[model samples]
Structures are given as C-alpha cells and as structure tokens.
Target: MRRLALVAALALSANAYPAQAQAVAETADPYIWLEDIYSPRAMAWVEAENARSLAVLKADPQFAGFYADALKIAEATDRIAMPRQIGGQIANLWQDGTHVHGLWRITSPAEYEKAEPAWQTLLDLDALSAAEKANWVWAGADCEPTAERRCLVALSDGGEDANIQREFDLATRSFVSGGFTLPKSKQWVSWETPDSLIAARDWGAGTMTASGYPFVVKRVKRGAPLEAASEVFRGKPDDVFVIPRTFTDGAGHSEVVIMRGITFFEAEFVRVTPQGTTPIAVPRKSTVTGLTQGRLIFQVNEDWTPAGGQPISAGSLVAVDPAGKAAPEVIFAPGPRQSVDADEVAVTQGHVLAAVYDNVRGRAMRFTRTASGWQQSVLPLPDNAAISMVSSDRASNTAYVSVQSYLLPTALWKVDAAAGTAIQIKQTPARFAADGLVTEQFMATSKDGTKVPYFITHRADMPLTGTTPTLMTAYGGFQISYTPAYSGVTGKLWLERGGAYVVANIRGGGEFGPAWHEAGLKTKRQVIYDDFAAVAEDLMARKITSPQKLGIYGGSNGGLLMGVELIQRPELFGAVSIQIPLLDMLRYEKLSAGASWVGEYGTMANPDEKAFWLKTSPYSNLKPGAPYPETLIWTTTKDDRVGPVQARKFAARMKEYGLPYLYYESTAGGHGAGANLKEKAMTIALEMVYFQRRLMDTK
Candidate 1:
C-alpha cells in the first residue's frame, strides 16, 4: 500500500506539472539573476530579436490580403469626425463597417441635415446587402440639446416597425429602444425618451405601456375597465432638478407648480403660489438637471464658477408644490466645511438620506431627515479598510458596501441602514483547502528605502522551501488600487490548482491614498516596477516560492508593466500573460487611440519625458540570448478603446525571437472582453483553461 501511494504521487507530480520546472531547480530571488541572463551592455542584440520578429510577420503574404479585406468595408463607409474629451482630436469615423448600417450620434441640427449626403452615399455602397440598407430606417439620426425639445425625423420607410430609438450624449452613445416581440412588429406605441420631462402609461388588453412624455391624463372608454391610472416618474431621477430663470426669482428660487395625475378630469395640484411660496435665495450660477422622479433639485454655488466646481460649499433642495402657494423648503444644508455632491443624497418616501464621505478622516457618515430635524450617524466600517458605498435598495431597506484592505480580499456586506447593523453577504470563495491557503503582508524596501506594502497568497500545505508555483498580478497606474475583489477566473484555476497568487499594492496605485498614486507616475514610474520586484523577492526570502515557478500577468498599463519586467528580468518569471499590453512606447503616442493615455503616461513630445519613458519602455529593452518567458498575448479587433494593433505588433516581435508564445485575438468584442453574458463567460473560461494548462504542469 505504501509503495502504491508513493508511485501515485510521483506519477502525478511528473506528468501533471509544467514540463519546464525540471530545468531550473535552484531556489533564488528571480531579480538577483537578471544580470546573468540580460545583457544591458549588448543592447543591440535585443533590438535585433525585435526586428527579426517584425520581419517574419510582415513577410507573410496572407497577412496583407487579410487586412485588405478587413479594411475594405471600413473604407466604403462615409466617415465623419466625432469629438472626444480625453484623447485630443479623437474621431469616430463611421463607415459601412458598422453592422447597424445608419448614421449614429448626430450632434446638432446642422449635422443632421448634413448627414443626408452621407446617408445617400451609404445607400449607394454596392457592398452592402439590401437588408442592411433597410436596417438604416430604424436608426434615429439626431439628438436635440434640451430635454424639453423633441426632434422627430420621418423614417425613409413610412412604417411603425422602423426601429427608432433615443441616444444619450455619454461617451458610449448608449441608446434606449422600445422593446417589441418581433423585429418588424407594427404595434405602434409611444415611449418616453431619456430626455423626456414627464412620463405617462396606458393600459391596453391587460398590458401597460408608456403613452408619451410631458404626460396628460386621459379618460377611459366605456365598457373597457382597468385599474386606477396615473402619470408617475419612470426612472430614478436625479437629486437636483433645475428650472429656467424665467420661472425663478432674482435669487433663483422659482414659484413652481407640480401636478400629479389623479383622475382624467381632476388632478392633485401642489403649487408654490407667489402668496404662499416665498422667494428663497439661490446662487445665480446654479444649474438644474431634472431627476428621474418629479422632484426638482438644483445645485447653488456662491462663486460664479460652475456649481460643479470644487467642493466645500453649501447647497439646498427646493421641492416645488403643484398648488402655486407653498414655497420650496431647504431639506439639506452643507455641513461646516464639508461639501455634498448631487450623488450623496438618496430620496425615499418623502424623506432624503445622504451618505457623506469625510475627506478628512477617510470615513463616511449617513444623515437622514426626521420630523424633529436632520439625524446623523457614523457608518460601521473597519478602521483600516477602505469603504465604497455602491447602491441602496429602498424597497428592501438594505445598502450594499464593499470593504477591502492590504491584508484582505474584498468582502461585500449588506448593511441595514435603519438598524445600523452589517451582515457579510458574500466572500471570495476559497479556491484551495483552508490548510493549503496562506496570506502574508510584507513591506518591501524600494531604492529610496520607502516601505511598499504587498500581499501574497500561497499553498500553506506546501513546504516553505521556495519551490511552489506562483503568479503575481499588479496594476500600478491611473491611481487604481488592486483590490481583492472576487474573481471567478483567478479563484478557480490559479489558486485551487496548488498554485500561489500575489497582489502587489505598489506605488502609482491609490491603495493608501492620492499621495501614494502620485509617487510612482511619469518620471517616477520605475518605482512601481521596483516595488513589484521587491514583493517577488520577499516571497523568495520567506521560502514561499522560487523564480522558476513565478509567472506575471497584467493588462492595459499593467500590460506595460509585464512587458518591461520581461525585458528587464527575463529569468524572473517562467511564463507571462500580456493581454492588450501597451507596447511600442515611442510610437504609442501615434497609434489610433494611444494619444489619450499621454496624460496618465507622460507624453514623448517633451525631451525630458521621452528620456524617462525610454528608460522603462519594454520595447526599447528587448535583448538577444536572453531566456524570455513563454508569453501569451490576447486582444480584440473590435477594441476601439485600446487598438488591437498594439498586441499584434508585440506578438509579431516575440515570434521573431523564436520564443514560445500564443496569440489569440477575438474578432468581435470591444475593449471589454465580450459584449454579452455568454461571450463573457466563454472568455473567462478560456483564460482559466489557458493559465491552468500552462502553470499546472511540472515535468
């Protein structure tokens, strides 16, 4: 029996584990061996490897044909320049490449009229199918400026089935379309757009549908019976709704009236009459955007600057009555030097609750209005843990809060605000057995002796001999913290399969605060890399893992981290996963959408900035004869946010080096891995399978 057990264990270890592990048996900090494999002096060798990789990819005859076919559709479309805020002079040159085959995001009336030529040109495109041209009829061409203004363009095909929808001005161009059972259903029904001032509902054949906006009461026909009908706010309205200056006093408080539809003939009226509604002082610079509900809320700024200017100012809420007599009352007041934004207030059942973040102590307070006055309470959150309140369910009387810290994975709790008690609702599932999972907090010494905090999770059952498989993940840019949220991908394959996981809260992240983020940006980017390496070494010193078992993974800016690490210390990790990495630092500023990242990553235009960027850019440091890790690069062709060409070029270079690697690009998905639920699940499954197959084998 003992012999059989020993044979079984050896068989599992030899065949199921990664084959490359047998080559390197020595236990050492991977960073220490960087000089041995990397030749900083013979830098030309690295550049040659990169050149050879590019040559092979460009030499492929089929590559050009494939790209030409792809570009053909894009070129046939009528392209227009759309403005974006972040990346300077960014445009969405839409052409025949769009599946929906129509004009999108018509900014103004002029643009709408001008689009007719493009629409006709689109119709003239011979490549498009007849059905594709028909799809254009459903598209809503233009968006007006104000919520009160409604612009209707007749469909080219005079049919109710023409799928028209309202689009918002947000970056994504999100549109709300009326739901129907069939693609060409002819049941004509009016729906409220996002910008609609009022919403009304009608009952027909036991079903209720929105009648229209700026709703009015209608009498029911005889012999047809239904439940009581009324017009109510459709969605969660904004807290502050602004009225025009024509309705407001010189101080900005308007003698407004709000009418609620009670019956077809009679309506419940509440008016702030000039006699009853007293003129309240309001800032002249105040602007009001209507909330989803009927209540009117506005922001008042003492300074002429926009109301959204810096915080630390007083604001009031003015609730207009339909009867033109009662004046608006101030429901909320700014507390001392603390400023409250529009999102801080939650209105429910004729009462308002506010969740105010104390910028001083880094804590949050909950304030509610009572009959006596305003009541205040301190929310219960761990002193060290950072808390972010996401949402509250008034119907359930429950609020969801996420809590995380350096030593802990994120945990979600359901807090009963009325009771002031928090209940842990969900926790990250333990991938490995309890005895096998271990977490440790360590402070790594940077070049300046700055103590950087990092955490490592590994198999406790494994011997502390620095030989266990390890994967380190970090995102040290954009002031975004690498918090321990529950990840279905990482939990199942990496940790559960006898591997280790480490999350490095290095500099350039907002883990500690804003100061921590500013510490490792631009000229200080090297600090983040240094901090990441130090954490890897700490794991080695503790005899928790070795360099042969180490693998690093990151995406986006973090992709840049993994790239630079591979160039700087090729021996540090056995495998690297670079997903949509931002490589080619010098030319990145020239890519289709790379210019936007210049704010976060300093622009190369400035000589000093270029010098600093060159020092850390992974593309600039690839050397020959270096034992590079087995890399897997992934990207999406439909990624308008981060162009797929970045990954394509990097993968091309790695292949030139004759390096072991895999390149997988999704033809149809945006910067987000997938568009729908099923696609998202499949992507996660693929990632898990890839990591497990690569990391679990030990020859």
Candidate 2:
C-alpha cells in the first residue's frame, strides 16, 4: 500500500497569483524550468506540449475510431492469459501484435487446463529488446521458491521503476552467464539461498531513501561484487523503503523478512536470523502477509495488542509464530463491510488465499490451520464478481482466481486450493455490448456526513434527464481499493459510445477499511476532497450527470484526485482527466517518489501540514481566468514514480495562466500513461478524445 503517488507548491496570495502568477506567490517556482527533466529547456517544452496536444487530440473525427478501438483492445490475443503459479509451470506475460516486448511464458499445470495451452517461451521480451539495444520493460520474476528453476529477471527501462536484475535460467532457457546481475536502482531482490541474495538496492552513495527507495539491506553471494555486498539491514535516511522478503513454507519453514518502510502507511517488520535482526511483533500498521504452517501471516493496518495477548481488530487477519511461541491467532476478522485484499494475499500449500472485500464485492477466503482452531472456507467464488488472486502455488494448493463485474466478462477461476473448489478456467471474449449495461451501487452523501460508495456503468433504459455523457473516477489515495473491474477500454472507448462511467467509493479508499483509509489522512485531506465532491454532487443530484454533463478522471493517487476536483470543485467538472499527476502540494517533497509520501502527505515540516498545503494545493488552487474544466493534463516522460516534475510544473502554470489546459508527455510510460501497447493505445486515444471533447461536444 505504499504506492502513495504525488503533489507540490504555492504559498498562495497576490490575489492567488496571475501576473505570471506572481512568480508563484513571489519568487522562485516560475515554472522551475519545468524541473529540468531532460533539459534543453525541458525537451523544448516537451516537444511543444506533445505537438500541441497531439494536434487537437489526433484531429478528432473520432480519432481514427479511438485509435482503432484502443489498438484492438490492446492487441487482444483472446486477452486473459493471466495465470502465474510457476511451479509445475503456468507463469505468463504474453502481449500481442506479435510480442511487443513480452512473451515470458511457461505452461504445464496440465497444459494450463487445456483450451489451447502449450506455451513455453520463457523470455522473449521482443527478442531481448532487439538483442539488448534495450527498451526492455517487463519488471517481474523472482523464481527460486525452492528451485522453480533459478530466476530473478526484472528488466524495466522504458517503463522505468529502475530495474535490471537478470540471472535467469529455467532449465537453461538462457541468461546466467556470470550470473546475478543487479545493475539498476529501485531494487528489492529475494531468494536468500540457492546461492544467496537478500538485497534492497543502490548500495553506493549513503544507500538511498529520501524516497528514491532502497534503505540498504544486502547479502548478495552468487558471484558477489555488488561492491562486495554484506550490510544486512539499515533503514533510516528518511526511511520509506527497505524491502527484502523471502518467506518459504513448503514443509521447510525458511525466513528472511525485513520490510522497514516507515511511512506511506507505516512499517517495520524484521526477522532475518543467522543470529540477528528480530523486531516483528507486528503493527506499525501491519503487513507481513504470507507463510503458512510455520505461521507469520499478519495484515492488521492498526489495532493490535500483543505483550500478553487478545485484541486484534483493524482489518484483522493475524497468525504470528515467527518462533515467538504462538498466541496470535485470529486469521480473518473483517466484516464491518470487510477488506483484506492486501494485493490479493496468497500463501497456499495448505491454504491462506484471502481476497475478501465484502461490500466492494469480491470473494475468496480459504484460511486453514487445523487441530481445533483456524478454519474459514468461502472460496466457491463467483457472486457480484471482482475476486482476483490469480496465482498462488507455494508448492501447490494450486490457485488462480480472476472473476469480473461492471457488465461481467472476465472469468478464469481454477482454484482447488485443497478443494474449497473453483473451476471455470478462462473466459473473456465479450469486449463490449453488455446488452443494456446496468451495474448499480450508489450511496453518495459526503460533505462530512460521510457515506460515499459509487459505481454507475449506465444506459439501463437511459434518460434520468440530465444529458448523460458522464465519466468520473477516483482513487482517493493509497489504501487503493477502487474496485469494479471489467474495462476493455471502458467498454470500447466510452461505454460503447453512449458514455457514463463513475467509480468513486472515495474517503481515501480501500473501499471501507483502516477506517476508510484513516478517514483521509495527513491534515485530513478534506475528507478526500469531500469524498470526490460527493461523487460529483451525487451525480448531479441523480439526474445522473450535469454541470454540463460532467467528466473527471484520475491517475497516480488519482492524479492527485484530478488535481483536487480541478481546484476544489470548479463548477463540478465538465472534463478534467489529469493523469499521472500530483499538482504541487508545496513542492511535493522535492518531487519524484515525493519523499516517500511523508506518511501519506503531511510534513511541510508540519505546521498543520503547512496549513493543509496552503488550503489544499492543486498547483496552489490554479486560479487565473477561473471557471476551469478543459483539463487533459497528462504526464509520463519516463515518470520515475510521480516525476515528470509535477506534470511539468502544472503544465507550466497553465501556460502562465492564459489558462485553458491540454498538455501531454509520454515518451514511454513509467508512472503509467503508456509504455507499450502502442503506448497504451495512444494514452487511450488521448483520453477518449479528451472525453469526447468534454462530455460529448455540442457546446
């Protein structure tokens, strides 16, 4: 959950700044040279704002049918290959239009329950990025869960989260020549055995972390020389990242934990041993998550007790043991509209699975301990969809989940985690036309009287009489739940062209737990922007879309919630988009990985979080000729996590306040706005032709 995302500047004044925004409320940030990212005057203002917003969003006429229906639903080779177990095979990766940097492959679990499996590739990545000229991408692979054929892999560059790990070798498929590489930076590594590797990277200059991660952990062995690794565990330097993680249980315990993180929703965890590092009593808003019979599960998020037992609660799950002699227990406890999906928990050898959710609708529980104690069950699966685990196998209880919703169509079940049963196996093929489209889930309320939830979808016999074109979105921030899946590019570029989308579930998300994301943390983020402007004033008071047929969108922490609903409700959105954002909450902690989110945004050396970033920062409340709306601000110039300098100093202070927005960045997706499927089908056909020129044209 440490995926915090971004924001930055302004101390607000000078009639909220316009004479060239009084050099950003007097002196300094006047578009801080667009944060020098690739200078030459910031790549000539990002190639003149990406050729003037991709020439009016690729000259509209439905931008070549929304970039050929989002590059045919991103090169759809019958879409859902998804599975990842990796022991008796299954792994995956694929990608189409003839492998545009993909195809990791591997199949077997009885040829992945057959409907045409045979797989096997084991690493093509567009022929190793054309034999290493390198645009690489595919950052995954750890392998060695007890000899699953030695791995490590990672890669990344164009999709940048600093990668390059290497090692490989699944029964000699390739790369191990003088093995265990490592090179790049934002790393973590694992295995801890079959020739060692505890890791957590960038061990050079004072070993990183004022959020560029790697708070030093090290061990390294197999052909050594990462400057002769050894360290073990360090952490401080403004903490936020120290990872490690090795945990095995296949009837042979094995350990190595580490974690550390210290903010962006806390952490500490520890363990290691060959006689050292212990800590682990759990609760620094807990996590650990996985390992079975030798115990260690965790989850928590805040409400534990320990030192002589009994209290648990905060989104509970528990378990414990790390040889501290039993007594932790719970292993489930959610129910106040449940929550548990710490990125779809998993473990499996004799079950743990988890996925939960409840009100945000998703299922799978499993659990299992035995001898008169922990037991659980649930996993039959399908029901108001969402589900997801998708890969488990700690030497087999077998796993893979998936399901779907918002007009269904996803499927892929295959569970059998010691027979709590599941079975479907692959489905997908219905890209759009959900008959009359329905999906409900409402609730709204919010300007303090809480509630929120959202959903939408549309056209069940239309006309609530408010000009429908809609859109809407939310992330609220980090606890990251924002559920209801099925998208095939928002059902083929905007609900098969009639529109209406939504999503909300606001209050700093995780749907409804950790007290709904600590009820919007750090300076209580205006109740997560009044729960996304009360789900856009409850969709314009249920006429279902107004304020000129609404429109909103988010990205990176919901693009700082679409730059705070475009400056605190600019007449409640006509269109905003703002992807990969963070629009300056006072120099979002000197940008990039924004100082690992001062514990979910609070420290401008905390004077009431600098008066809530001078009254809630969207680039210091973007003022100038004010009634906002036309936004589409985009990001990604290889975003090393929220970098493209706060979307290039908020699109160069909205082009020095002459205002009307539209800017783009892209040169390869990093903080995701696209890196591959034809740069994510030209950033979803330039955000569905800028939400069809702001909520279906005809102004």
Candidate 3:
C-alpha cells in the first residue's frame, strides 16, 4: 500500500504565488510520484489496481453478455456511416470488427444518397499500422483549397492528441515522396499554398505555452526542414495555443486568419496577407466560423457595442467584410430563450446554416446575404429533436444535417441551401427496442432558486413506487449544452433491463447561452452542483427513484462534477463514475493542458480562488470515515489533454483514507477512452456491469 504522506514539501515558486499560501500548500501530498506518468512505481500500482478491480467486475455473471452486446453494437457494419462533404466527394471514416483502426473511405454525392453507398477505400489504417508496426489512429485530412488533390493527413500514435502530418496525393492514392512531413507533436497546420505550409507546433525551446501547446506559428516551404521554417507569427508563452486557419469561399476568395488564444474563451484574430497581418475587429469571446463572399462570419458570446456602432447582444451571428466596405451585418441574433450551437454552424456557397437550441430544443436556420440585407429562414426539419449541421460544401449550396431524439435513431438530411429544400437521405437502423420507452422533460429549482431543466427516459408505464434503478448524468461546465441524442447502448443495456436514465441540463452550460454558463463560473459553481443535486432530489420527490437506487456518471469536466457530488451529496447516489477527472484543483494548472482552462476555472494564484478550492476541492475534502459510495474512477494513460495524474492521485488518496473505490486506467486512448472499438466496448460494458451491481442489485 502507498503511504498517505510524503517527506518533502510541495514547493511553489514565490513568483507564482504569495509566500504564505505557497508555504501552506507545500505540505506533503502522498501521491506526487504518480505525476510521473510512466514511472515504475506508478505502473506497478496501476497494474495491481487494474488486476484487483478487473477480477471483481469481470467475474460478474452478466459481464460477458454485456461485453458481447456492447461489442456487437460497436462493431456493427449496419451502423450509419457519418459523411462529410470534402473535395467533391462524401468522405467517412468507418470502423468495424475487421477494421479496428478504421478505413478512411470516400464516395460520390450521387452514390452516397443510396442505401448502400459504393465507397472506395482511401486509406486502410489497419493495413498501414500492420505494415509500419505502429499503433496509428486517423486524426483527419485537410485538402488544399482550390485543387483539393494534395492533402495533409494527420495520424496519431496510439490515441494522443499529438500527431504527425504527412502530405498525400488523392490523384496517386499515395504519400508524396519527399513531401511535407511534420514529426509527431501537438500542432496545428493549414495549407498556405500548394507549395508552402503554415503550422504551429513544438518549434524549439521557448516555443510552447504553459498549457503544453504551441504558441508560435511558422511557415515551411515544400523542401524546407522543420528547423529551417521561418517564423510567421509569435504569441506569448503564457498564452494558450495559437492557430492559423485558411478559409475559402465559393467565389475563389481565400483568407488566412491567425488566432492567438489569450485564454480558453478569449482570443485575438488577425488576417494574414502578403502585405502584413491586420487585426480583424471582433469581440474577445467570439469565433470566426468561415469566410463567405469576402465576409468573415462569426458568433459573439458576449454582448458588444463597437465605437460609434449599434450594440449587438450576446449569442448573435454577425458578418463583417475584411475590406471594411460594408457595415457589419447581424445575420442572426438569438432570442432570450435561443442559443446558437457553435459546433453546428457552417458556411455554404450561398448561405450560412446554423443550428440553435430554442428552449433546450433544436432548430436550424439558413442565413443568406441578399441585396436588401441578411435574410433568415428556418430550415424545414423534424422538431422535438436535436438537429445539427453535419457537413457543408463551399463549392456548392449542398449540405448535410443530422437529427436525433432520446427515442429516435439519428437520421441524415441533405439540404439545398440555394433552393431552401431539405430531404431525409439516410438513417441509422434501430439497434435496440424503443417501442415501450418514453422521454419527458422536467425542471428542478436549485438552492439559489434557479430552475434547471432535465430529461428522463424510461418505460411509459413506470410506477411511482420510487424503486426503479436509475442513473443520472450531467456536464455542467465549459459552455457546452447537453442536448437529447439517442443512445443505443443506454437503451439496450440499461433501459432494456428495467432501469431509468436522466440527463440534467444544469447551470454552467450553454443551454441558455453565455449567461447560463457564466452564471456558475469560479466560486459561483456551487449552483451548478446544486442544480444537479436538486434534480436528483426531484426524482425522489416524484417517486421515480430513491437515493439507494440512483447512480451518476460523467467524464472530463463532468468528471469534476461527479467528484464534487460524491463529496457534497453522498447520500443522493449509490454509485459515482468519475472518468478522466480533474480532482486536485490546486495543482490542476500544473498538469497537462490544464492551464488553458483558467478562463473556465480560475487559477489558485488568486487569493479568493485559492480559498474556494480549499473548501471545494475533492482531493482535499476526502475524509477517513465519510459515508461515500464506491466510485468507479477510470482514466487513460494516454490522456494528454487532462492527464491521468489527477485521477491517479485522487484514487490513491481515496485508498489512503480507506474509502470504497475502484480504479482502472487504460494504457492507451487519450482524452476519450479506448483506442479501438473493442476497448471502447469493454469500457462501456464495465460501466454497465458496475451500474447494474451498484444500483440495480437489491439484496
């Protein structure tokens, strides 16, 4: 067993913090050695912990059945091949039992509309991995703007975010000899031209940010080595990642824009030209989605009033020309109850398609810059479902969208933005039985009297006996909205087994736009946790389920929520699954990519923020004899984004306190767990088994 405390004090530099606070925080933490991710002691401990936990969980009578079912669903060839319009073809990365790594394939738009599209394999990752004797994962491919023949293909080793970019030719179906090949590193790259590349990675010493990301952008010619690359732009080392993106419109108009991330939610954008880089006027909390008709289309998250200009409210889509010839136009300003889905916004040849959540439900709108002004019209699609833009083509007014509800499988819709017409093209075959299941939305008032909405899916005839085994989850951070989507695994594994599931749209999320998220930032985050706990209590109040029958799970930021809930509201849940969590708030900034999130979670260097963590940090709050539920804590060794150190230290501290817990860390799989389909299936199956044992098994 590991010791509870170490001998040496944790030294925080005087420059980084106040002397007194640094001295106070220097007190020994037992598992600091776990921070050395590949150290011998850490690996040994992980091995033993995995063996111990797997022995019990895999011994469950239903584990094999659960694993088989999950695997079947994961590797099913009938699964929908999600398509993206690229280079005049519909491209998709498909994985099955045979193609574990995946097969990057492409088909024509006409053939893709059919039930069984004729796909030609562009890259066989499995064969490539086998030949190279390396575990390669397909990241993505970026094609040149005009010709769309030469492309930069990114491949990750194992599943880490850091990858190598190799220039490949679509015409020859092979990698270009002596072409642009960037070594493996956490980087961002875009084509400056057919002969030159603009990139940001680990250029050399003093080039990386504190967040383990590249802050320097450089331009490399076709035959130049990385060392010979010339500096194009330089951001501060304290800043987050810097990216140079090129946007092209239908009229052969192309613009290269460089973004220097001041923080996670803030940035400075500049248009790069042969003359010089010029500042693109936009709010700090705004993103330039694309360039359409020489106009930069962007969405602002904060209300802005320009100098001698009209005030634009928060959550508004607007466009501005780089030439400053035309005044800024408000494409779409969301209503009070409407919030734009940032990930769903796309620019096509003749229109800008954006998906917005209206009162937590989805609606798609098309914005076109007409002679009069910007005209907005709602796209004709299924309502009461989560609608999202899948892909859009800049060469044509063709796009694809997806719609899915809690009970409805996902369906693909092809839209003609020019004609304002949409048709359902393809849909996923139902993986599980949903005939008897129903979904309903409910609202629960938080401790501060703020109403939070949540959705529950269960049998229509469920009795109000408060005995149903229920599992609830929520991600209440990062300005991300948790919308309704069909989950075949949850429906087939849990719902089919007489269990109910809940999704709480609590505070600290973008459900109602920036205001809703900013309402729970920093010390005000207690309300987000309160909203989740309130939803659990509301379920009990409605006789849906009791405390002993309730389980909750989340990953990444959501994992942090689970940790807080396990400490703050232990009696409300039977099991808590914290996956790839950030537990040690005091030291989170020192971990991988953690410093980038200071915009969302405040830094400990601030006196008030330090005080808040002292009270709310889960690792610091765990006691010897708390009535805590046995937690399923899991993370990946290759999770370079959040890093596994936080999870490891938290679990080690739990052990020191003699608390009930289970820890499993996979050797691969990066931020999102499981390197391959089988691994992912096993992880899901393990969760199902653990939930069944903790929440459903009545003695």
* Candidate that would win on lDDT: 3
**Lowest-lDDT window of 10 residues in candidate 3?**
1-10
Would you estimate the TM-scores of all the predictions?
0.52, 0.32, 0.96
Q: Can you give the lDDT of residue 525 in candidate 3?
A: 82
- The per-prediction tally of clashing pairs is 35, 13, 0
Error of 2 at 297 (Å): 7.5
Candidate 2 structure quality by residue, lDDT tens digits, 360-423? 9887778888888788888877876788787888777878888898788888988877878988
The global C-alpha lDDT for each of the candidates, from Candidate 1 onward, is 0.47, 0.81, 0.88
Output the worst ten-in-a-row residue range by lDDT, candidate 1.
236-245
lDDT for 175 (candidate 3): 90
**Candidate 3 regions off by >4 Å?**
1-26
Using lDDT as the measure, name the better of candidate 1 and candidate 2: 2
Model 1 Cα lDDT, one tens digit per residue, 251-296? 2233233333222111233333334423333344333322212344
**Which residue segments of model 1 deviate by more than 4 Å?**
1-390, 393-398, 402-436, 681-690
The best candidate by TM-score is 3
